[model samples]
Target: MSSSTSSSEPTAAWARFLRLLLLFAAVPAAIAYAFIALVDPWGMLPLSLPLRRETVTTNQRFSYPMIAQDPRFDSVVVGTSTSRLLRPAQLDELFGARFANLSMNSGTAWEQAQLLALFTRRHPAPRVVMVGLDKEWCESGPLRRLTPRPFPEWMYGGNPWRGYGEILNPFAAEEAGKQALAMLRLARPRYGRDGYADFLPNDARYDAARAAQSLVPPPAAPAAADPAFEFPQHALLAERLAALPAVTRAVLFFVPYHVSLQPRPGTLDEQRMEACRAAITRIAKARPGTALADFMIPSPITREDTHYWDPQHYRIGIAERLARGLAAAAEGHPSAEGDYVLLVPPVGH
Candidate 1:
């Protein structure tokens, strides 16, 4: 009986230790997860504590979907980093609708299409749907149309419960703390509540020498045209635009690539790009309120090295100019400046 009692005591002690271990580990973990869930930095949780959530995270793939679904924004700016410079407030002023620039850095055609579909479904009678046309739209043949940054497809669903657990990670916790701190004005916001951010380097930090290096293109003789060249993603763009309500004015523009990066006038490169543009123009033509602003040509915007930060992204002043130009194009104003061609004019015009 004594031996049995002694053995049973050890078993009970071991069980107690196990319980303590679990308590120490589980309690803190649960608290951490609860903190993250309640703060809901991504705004993907139902338990979100109604924090005035400005974008606190740099991962736009995770942050911007909430902005896309925001009812305050009836219109959305969709594109890659090329479109990030377009300010939503300015766009709202220009287009007379609330705007959210939901452009993702290196955002693929697939991601853009998905997010756009999400926005059109969430909003009612969206005013102006502007898409910054990128080279990826002309991407031909067997493209998976994905980028290295993981788009949170899980967040776009109707059920918030499915995505709540995803925010329990350390990164999400850190962002949650930042989100809280942002509320207190202790942490700086990465993006505006309307999803606009000046992600480019400050004008004070402008390094022309370094900028020059990024502008230089590799040795390029015009490419030989393949009979198989196709703009597969144009169909995807059309489908997303189709999903928008008939009243939504769609503006599609080819983002200005640097002249060196743009195709030579008579080259096969030019042939392929123009072919893609023609198809895109046709898509825009079918939709009455849609307009196509063609900026992917060798003009002042593309040729002037001082105007651009790199081959793809332009300076802030230039971005604002483009915004105003887009507004003008939307109003059916002809490009008298010879900068861009308004391919498919707006409906009333």
Candidate 2:
């Protein structure tokens, strides 16, 4: 009987230990879940916590879609950091339609494609779409994903259930807390209403030497029968744009990159860019009401370093000019010389 009692004593002790362990684990988890449910960062839960009117502070990959799908916006500007300076309000006024700038920093072509697809697939198709084409979209690797930091697919995907798990993440929780504080007026919004964030100072100075250094010719490559230009991703972009109905005006404009970003006038890189441009031109021709505004061509804006904050990014003023020029081109009006060439399809195509 004594031996049996001792054995049972150990069993009871183990049972108590298990209960304590479960409580310890369950309590914190319950608290965390409760917190996440309350926060509901990605709007996955039923709790509609008044998240601040976030513009720039939020991860654009996650936030842009939410705003784009709001149905209030009928026009959208999609591109990389080069396109972020564009104000949605400006586009709205220019085109006389509600607009949202869905550009992200280093936003990959695949990512942009996904966002565009998501936007167009909605019940009411978008009225206008402006794609800010750049090297990333024109270069190879259609299947290639975003690098350095992968785009969060769960947040962008149609499944709301998966988003609950996303908000439970530590990083997302931190963002939720920031949003909560901002909503409560404890913090300020990180960006303005139009999703324009000025990362560079307005008074940024240009150094001639620095610009010269950036212009150093790249090492020569072995001569080929034709310049090695691979742009399968651009084809995908064309396909998506073509899928849009004739009512939608799709504008594909090459960002006016600084001379440094562009290849030397007659080099192999120039050849590659030309090939990409030709391919895009073909796509534009195939689709009715689609226009290709070739700002990638030689231009005063592309030549002047003073007009740019960096070799790749132009100033906000340039963005304004580009916006005005695009608006003018869309209306069949003349714009500033040497800025862009507006290519429209032949009449009655």
Candidate 3:
């Protein structure tokens, strides 16, 4: 009887140890999950909990998907760094539609397509899809389609189940925690709700010598063919938007690159720019009502060094002018003579 009692004691102790181990592991796991569900930064869960919007971290890969899915905005601004200057509120007043700028750094054409696809799929058809046409829009071949980083396919897919992994991720969790803490203290967000923050100094100081240096391309044989470029996708973008039920306006504006940035006439760069513009123009003419505002052509705005800080990026004032001009053109009203030429269909074609 004594031997049996000792053996039973060992068995009971082992069971107790196993239970303790399970409890220890379960506690932290449960706590983590609870925190994630409560914070819900990625909007993966259906809880509709209010986020600390004041703590707007610049997480475009995550934030953009949320914005695109949101039903509040009826228009989207898609482009690269150059497009960020166009304020959404200003655009809203100009175009008579709620707009959200989804532009990011080095945003490629393919990335724009994915973003547009995501926006159109999850939310109601947008009334307008304004594309800021840049050199990236004219890219062709494998290199042209590739973005610097892979777009988060899972996030863009609009599948809540698939998003759990991103939602509960360590990085996401850390950001969520920070956001919660910041909310308690009323901290300001890194980026605005419009997803814009002026990265450059507002002062547009003119230095012609400095600007001219950027104009010179790398040494290459004069006979060497210009890098391959194609604009079919840009045209396709217009066509696709025009096909959508709610899409009444599809505006493609050539961002106002300064004069130094414009290639010299009869040069390969000039030829390439014309080719791209021609392709886009053809599409605009065919579609009718699609506004083609060309700023690439040497104009008053382009020639003015005061309008641009760098060779390419113009200042906010230029963006304001563009918004007003493009808006007027879209509405069939004549825009004031300025840096850009607005050609609404048959008139320009």
Candidate 4:
């Protein structure tokens, strides 16, 4: 009886050992498969490759290294693609300070505010944050189209690991995966050498060339005064502006839109625009160190569709003018000198 019992015990132990081995092996395999599927390795993976000759041919000149290398940027331009025309180099030249354009396509006020918070956490708070405001940004709607895919949070929020990778291998696996997916989704254009050049013009000569052709026009008055319009983002703008660190100087610029597209009487556009302007005015007046440079007036260049890539965004030439104006505004204002923390007032008053 004792011998029979011992044999049965050995057999049971063997079966239990096998089950444990299988469980461990299955876990890793499942995890790997899930990562590959969500990352869509083959389809969106290639965008992670660093700047190569072949890759540069098609893309204008977008290099992650270019942004990562410039840590001394004391001035940052924030906004959607409409503000893309303002080159960091020009601002540096004009202000005798380092600057970088952190603008992205279809960027919203909320996104900009988030980015500002992120920027402050890492590098020294920029002396001047040139925030580009447009009527579209004031629209009260979810920014569904601007949603970026889930990436390492640090990618946008300034995580050290991602920041290191961004500097070392700007075309790392994750970025490539995100860019690839963006391409498949038709969200962003494929990368090429010219990609950077296309957006970041090498010189101001293009503006001169376009101006000589009689393509640009003089500045005109505001399209119309529709006071009933409400700026949907008023509360949000005030909140974010107030939250900025006291030391960082904030300057708001109202980007010009085509007069032809101005909202008609009693239309949603007019109402929204009016609300945004009023909200902006209120914030500008109340904030101790904050100021506004309203440049929404129609310009000769703005009148031409060619001057703008779309209804709201201006061409690179127009962007240069905006940059110059921003520089002038910054220089003209003495209030920008000291550190000022932007605090949110109590909800009711």
For 288-336, candidate 2 gives per-residue lDDT tens digits of 7777787776687888766766667777788889998888766655446
Scanning candidate 4 in windows of ten residues, the lowest lDDT window is 340-349
- Give me candidate 3's TM-score against the actual structure: 0.80
Q: How high is each candidate's TM-score?
A: 0.92, 0.89, 0.80, 0.58
How many residue pairs clash in each candidate at the backbone level? 0, 0, 0, 30
Candidate 2 vs candidate 4, TM-score winner: 2
Kindly provide the TM-score of model 4 when superposed on the true structure, using C-alpha atoms: 0.58
State each model's CA lDDT, in order: 0.84, 0.72, 0.70, 0.54
Q: List the residue pairs that clash in candidate 3.
A: none
**Model 4 per-residue lDDT tens digits across residues 108-186:** 5666655555555445556666788875467755543334522233434434433433322324444444544554663
Q: Compared with the true structure, what per-residue lDDT tens digits does model 3 show for residues 133-234?
A: 887876644445545564667766666666555555576677677667666765655556666666666355556566555654343223226555566567
User: Which scores higher on lDDT, 2 or 3?
Assistant: 2
Compose the digit string of candidate 1's lDDT tens values, residues 254-321: 99888878877657667778788888989998877888999888887888888888899899998998
- Rank by lDDT, highest first: 1, 2, 3, 4
Best by TM-score: 1
Model 2 has a clash total of 0
